[model samples]
Target: MIKILAVGDVIGRPGRQALQVGLAKVRESMTPDFIIVNGENSAGGFGITRKIFDDFINSCGVDCVTMGNHWMDKRDIYEFRDHPQIVLPANMSNVDDPAKGLRILESKSGVRVAVMNLLGKVFMKGENSCPFAMVDKMLDLTPSYVKVRLLDVHAEATSEKQGLGQYLAGRLSAVYGTHSHVPTADERILKNHTGFVTDLGMTGPYDSVIGIDPDSAVRRLRTGEKRNFEPAKNDLWFYGMLFEINEDSGACTGVHRLRFPAKDS
Candidate 1:
């Protein structure tokens, strides 16, 4: 079985620090064969920067970096959007470039893995295409030799994410949810072939509202106040999923949730 560690969205500076601390602890113990992180909000809680992306791969030992709706918030992403390690949303209606949506990379164990990203349209601002159709097309285009497929469906609705996971149960090795910073309790193996989770959660300040300052979030949510937002500083945590996949058949044999700073650790 090949172990893959999939992390949730990194919020901001606090998240980066948590990543540094949590990753070191997990790497020393769990020692995942491959690692993928959702970093759409790594840059000041909006979008990822080129430096942060490189740091995630070079310093953090992350194999793949997935994106979400806020991916374009940094604006500098175009400088390195074509990088092999980075992936953007495939079905984003506003995106004219379609190159980074899907990528096939060789893991540390020399296994080729297909990684894809898609955006959800429900309650989201953009008018993106149907994720089901787009993913089906993307899967068809992927070379048959490459198994162990993974997807980061950065979406809003739980129903939509679960529906997509159920739809692609036997076809893909794993289907995970992101975008929503809060983690869900529902995580299981779908059809005994795929590892699925509603949301891996955010690797940032858990004491606040979805990684942001609670006061700011309250103002924005309750009063529709417009102001600059700030990332929370306390209670940093890293949330993710670990999957053990049968390399030959591309079936997930076992799955585990990873939360750093365990009591035993």
Candidate 2:
């Protein structure tokens, strides 16, 4: 079986620290064959920087980093967009990267895996392509040798995320949600083949409003201020999902949700 861990969006510096601590604890209990994290908000809760990306790969030993609507918020991303560990939203309307939403990677145990990301149109601001159509094309183009396939649906609506999970139930090994910053309770196997989750939740300061400072988030929300937001500094948390897949059949055998407070990590 291939063990894969998918972490929720990393909010900011606190989230980064939570990640390192959480990884330390997970290593003490169980080691994952592969680990992927959504880091679109790692840089001051807006977008990830190249330096943060490098630390995630080199320091945290992450396998892949996924992004969402804010993928372009950090200009430094363009410098490392081609890096093997970075996975951008495939259906992004203005994106023209080489990965094309699908990346074939090798796990620590030498199992071939593929990571894909898609942007949703429901309640979103981009003129992105149809995620369903784009995913079908991506799967068709993906090499057959890569069996363990995983996708991160960076969406806002729970229904849209769940619908996509069902749409690719038997085709993909796992279909999980991201971008909402609130983790959902649903984590299960679909059609006895695919692992599904509504959302992986936020991996940062839970005390704040979705990782932003309480005062700043409310200041803009209540007063319609245009000032930049800052990340919260306390009450760190970690959120993620773990999936066990049949390496040869590319079927998910087990799916579990994982959450940890700063104290536990």
Candidate 3:
């Protein structure tokens, strides 16, 4: 069995710290073959930085980092976007973007896994190309040696995420959603043996509104003012999913949602 760990959006410093704590426990209990984290919000809840990316890969034991709409929020990303361990949203119509949308990485056990990042259009910013079509192009581009595949659908609407999961059920090993920052209860294997989830949630403070400071988020919602949002520091937790795949068939046999709260919490 090839076990893969797919983590949700890392909010900020708190989220990164929570990941370190939670992943330590996971490693002690049952180490996964490959670890994938959504680092789109890793840097101050905006975008990832080189330091955070290194921490995730070197310190946190993450094999790959997936990004979302905020892929360009931090200017430093441009310097290291070409890193093979990072993947950005593929549907960006801008062909000039230096970062790639898909990557095929080899696990320590020699299992080839293809990871793809995609953005959603519904209730999202930017002119995103058709996710359905883009996914097809990505699958076609995947090399034959890489059978196991996972897609991080960084989307807002559950419908769009579900649709994409269904659209590529058998073709991909797993399809999981992100960006909502609230974990969904639904997790199941599709009829075609692919694992699916609406959202993997956020690895940050659960006490606040989606990892933002409660006061600031509430004030913005109540006053309709564009208030500066900061990552909350209380009640930190790590949200993610675990998938057990059959190496020969590239089918997901087991899907489990993971939520590990801070030990002190």
Compare the candidates by TM-score and give the number of the best one: 2
What's the distance in Å from true for residue 13, model 1?
0.5
> Alpha carbon lDDT of residue 75, candidate 1?
79
**lDDT ranking, high to low:** 2, 3, 1
TM-score per candidate, in order?
0.96, 0.97, 0.96
- As for model 2, its CA RMSD to the true structure in angstroms is 1.4
In candidate 2, residue 248 scores what lDDT? 95
Q: Model 1, 1-265: lDDT tens per residue?
A: 7899999999898899888788888888877888999999999999998889989999989999999999889978989888998888989986634456889998899998889999988988878989998888889878888879999999999999999999999999999999999999788999999899999999989888999998888899998995768788888888999999988899998889988642113
Kindly report which residue pairs in candidate 1 clash with one another: none
> Best lDDT goes to which candidate?
2
Candidate 3 residue spans exceeding 4 A from truth: 94-99
**How many residue pairs clash in model 1?**
0
Residue-level lDDT of model 2, residues 65-125, one tens digit each, is 9899998898988888777778889889977332667888899999999999998889999
Q: In model 1, state the lDDT of residue 57.
A: 94
Clashing pairs in 3: none
Angstrom error of the Cα, residue 7, model 1: value is 0.3
